[model samples]
Target: MNYWLFKSEPDAYSLSDLKNDNNSTGRWDGIRNYQARNLLRDEVKVGDLVLFYHSSCKNIGVAGTAKVVSAPYPDPLQFNPESKYYDPKSSPDKPRWVCLDIQYQQECIKFVPLPLIKATKELDEMILVKRGRLSIQPVSPNEWNIIMKLGKLVC
Candidate 1:
């Protein structure tokens, strides 16, 4: 299955929040960017693995692993006028955004911070290290292995 990195602000929805969700699973919603939305709708699939990265925080890095439990579906938040992610241009028949359901897998014993990732030559080509702003990004198997090793988590 394809591997991916899913970034979230710890203050908004941290890995801990996912772990604490009912059944340790929840819908991954609120993706607004076109590129990120496309990835979620097209590339991401159920059973794919995800590196849960905590961004816009003091320790930005892959904090845990999660497994996609559902296929891409229209983001319900987009249809809700009260949601911050709501899109006036989108409708039930034509959705502009998509999301997936992911189940918490395992939290890292030690978070692999950005500095550590940047120091590793093998991870030089990672989109995250390249300052990519997309919330959902594909990850190479090698990169996934390296990050898992660094985070002290079983791959």
Candidate 2:
């Protein structure tokens, strides 16, 4: 299965929140960027692993792991007018956004901080280190392995 990194602000939806969800599964939605949306719709799939990164928080880093548990589906919030993620241009017949479910795996034994990742020579090519604004990013197997090791997580 492919590896990915999914970012969420801890205050909005932290790894802890995901772990506390029913069956430790939650919908990953509200992605407004076309690039990130495309990845979720066309590339991400069931059983793929996810590095749950906490961003826009006091402590930003890869906090834990998760597994994609569902295939891509139209984001329900896109049709709701009250939702901030709602798109007036999108409809059920033509969805402009997509999402999926992910189940919490395990919290990292040692939180791999961003500074630590940046300082690690092996991760210099990682997307997070190079261009990190994307909310969802593909992670190479080697990069994944190194990050897991840094987090003290079993691959």
Candidate 3:
């Protein structure tokens, strides 16, 4: 399975919010960027693991883990005019955006902070350390293992 890092603002949709969702599963939606949208639509799949990173918050870091529980599907909000994510140019026949579902796995006990990740020599090549502006990113297996260890969670 693929390994990915999904960034979410804690204030908007934190790992805690995901854990508290019904069945601890929630739709990962509102991805507007074409690059991020393409990843969700074409690459991400069911059973893939996710590093739930809390961004734009006081504690910016990989907070926990999640598992992709569904295949990519057209984001329902895109069709709703009232939704901020709605796209006037998109329709049911031609979707311009996609999203998936992920289930909460385990919260990190140690809370691997961003500074800690950036300082680690082994994580020097991590996309997070290099170019982390993307809301979604790919994580190498080695990077994943190290981060999991740092988070004090079972690999």
Candidate 4:
């Protein structure tokens, strides 16, 4: 299964929020970027692993784990005019956005703080480095392996 990373603002939706959801699952929506939307709608599949990264906050890092639980579909928010993520260009007949549902798995117990990632000599070319602000990104196989070796998760 393909591996991926998704970033969310802690104040907007934290790992705890996912854990507390009914069934600990929720749709990942409001993606405005076509690239990110494509990843969710066309590539990500159920059982795929996801790194829940917390961005735009202190201690930005991988906060927990989650797995895709549902098939991709047009993001409802894109059709809702009231939503900040609503897109006027997206028509129901031709959807311009997509989303997925991810089920919470486990927490990392300790933040892998962004600073640490930057300091890691091997992760210099990680997508997170080039696309610092993309809400969703594909993690390279090498990058994933390096992160797994960080040993920062609480035992």
Candidate 5:
């Protein structure tokens, strides 16, 4: 299965919120960037591994692991006028956005902070660094392994 990293502001939708959901899942929405949009709509698949990253705050880090438990589907928020993510030009026949359900696996003992990961020479080539400000990015197998190990799940 493919691997990915998804970031969300803790204040808006924290890891706990995802965990608290009935099925330990939630629809990832509000992505507008073309690249991030493609990842959510096309690349992500059920069973794909994900690093749930907390972004835009002091707790910027990979808090836990999760799995994409469902196939991509149109984000309902994109069709709701009340939602900030609503797109006026989108139609039911032609969805402009998609989202996936993420099921929490387990929280890492110590979240691997962005700063720490950046400081590591091994992660220099990671998409999180090379892509710069991307809210969602692909994580290579090697990089995922290193990170999972760093999170002390090396076993």
Candidate 6:
């Protein structure tokens, strides 16, 4: 399975919120950027692992892990007029966005802050260190393992 990093704001939807969802799974949706949307629709898949990163908050860092539990599917919110993520031009027959279902794997023993990640020599090549703003990003296996180690995971 591939590795990925999924960023969410703590106030909007924290790692604990994901963990508290029914079966500890929730729809990974509301992505408006074409690049991030494309990753959800075309690349992210069932059983793939995700690093749950908390972004746009006072505590910005990788909070935990999750596993993609479902295949790509049309984001229903795109069709709802009341939704902040709603797209007026998108139709059921031609959806502009897609989402995955992710289940909580485990919280990190210690949150790996952004500063630490940026300072680590092994992670200098990581997308988060350079790109900083993509909501969803692919993570290399080596990067994933190193981050996991920093979070106190044996993997």
Runs of candidate 6 exceeding 4 Å displacement: none
Better of 2 and 6 by lDDT: 2
Better of 3 and 5 by lDDT: 3
Residue lDDT tens for model 1, 1-155: 99999999999999999999989998899999999988998899889999999999998989999999998999999999999999999999998889889999999998999899999999999998896688999999999999999999998
Clashing residue pairs in candidate 5 are none
> Ten-residue segment with the worst summed lDDT in candidate 4?
146-155
TM-score computed on alpha carbons, candidate 3: 0.98
Q: How many clashing pairs in candidate 4? A: 0
lDDT of 4 by residue, 78-138 (tens): 8889999898998999988888899998887566778888899898888887668777888
What lDDT does candidate 2 reach at residue 102?
A: 99
Q: Give per-residue CA lDDT, model 6, range 1-155, as digits (tens).
A: 89999999999998999999999999999999999999988898899999999999998999999999999999999999999999999999999999889999999999999999999999998999998799999999999999999999757
Clashing pairs in 3: none
TM-score of each: 0.97, 0.99, 0.98, 0.90, 0.95, 0.98
Q: List the residue pairs that clash in candidate 6.
A: none
Query: Which candidate do you rate higher for TM-score, 1 or 4?
Result: 1
Q: Can you give the lDDT of residue 31 in candidate 4?
A: 86
Can you tell me which runs of candidate 1 are displaced by over 4 Å? none
Instruction: Give candidate 2 regions above 4 Å deviation.
Output: none
Q: What TM-score does candidate 5 reach?
A: 0.95
- Winner on TM-score (4 vs 5): 5
Q: lDDT of candidate 1?
A: 0.94
Q: Which pairs, if any, clash in model 4?
A: none
- Per-candidate alpha-carbon RMSD to the true structure: 0.8, 0.5, 0.6, 2.0, 1.2, 0.7
Residue 5, candidate 1: how far off, in angstroms?
Answer: 0.3
In model 3, the runs with Cα more than 4 Å from the true position are none
**Which one wins by TM-score: 2 or 5?**
2
